[model samples]
Target: MTLGTSTSPLHYYDVSSVDGFNLQVSMVPVGGGVGCGVTGCETDLNICSPSTFE
Candidate 1:
């Protein structure tokens, strides 16, 4: 899991499968935020990227 910060109007991410074979990705925005300032941000983004050899 990794956290990324961007102020750009548009953001793009490239998620590739193992060894750039599958190129699949799972993305979603964070929830609640509660007291934190981050009310809208991609959270728990999982990219089960794996190498084809593996």
Candidate 2:
């Protein structure tokens, strides 16, 4: 399984407020169990702080 999270550009600078947006994600599954021949897959995910922008 894979996982990830989206980031906002407004986070770079100190802004008063902003509108609304969605954190969209897309993935394409491979055929069969053909992978890197490893036991399992390695995840490269980004963990974002929930209360950072709030």
Candidate 3:
């Protein structure tokens, strides 16, 4: 998603696999301000065993 003016603005974004989980995804904001940092799923959910959900 986008925030602020188009000329000079801030941006917020992340990778999502809501419908389905394929490859691992992550997001790291460089030189970010407060509350801005890395976010994502580093795990390989595709190969996870059913027991893992328990």
Return the top candidate by lDDT: 3
Model 2 over residues 1-54: C-alpha lDDT tens digits? 532337532211121223322233333444534432223213322234255554
lDDT of each: 0.40, 0.32, 0.69
**Candidates arranged by lDDT, highest first:** 3, 1, 2
Better of 2 and 3 by lDDT: 3
Candidate 3 minimal-lDDT segment of 10 residues: 45-54
Best by TM-score: 3
Please write out the lDDT profile of model 3 over residues 23-53, one tens digit for every residue.
6677777777888877888787767736544
The digit string of per-residue lDDT tens for model 1 on 10-33 reads 434444443534343455545624
Q: Write down the worst ten-residue block by lDDT for model 2.
A: 8-17
TM-score for all models, in order of appearance = 0.23, 0.18, 0.46
- Clash pairs, candidate 3, are none
| Residue-level error in angstroms, candidate 1, position 31 | 6.2
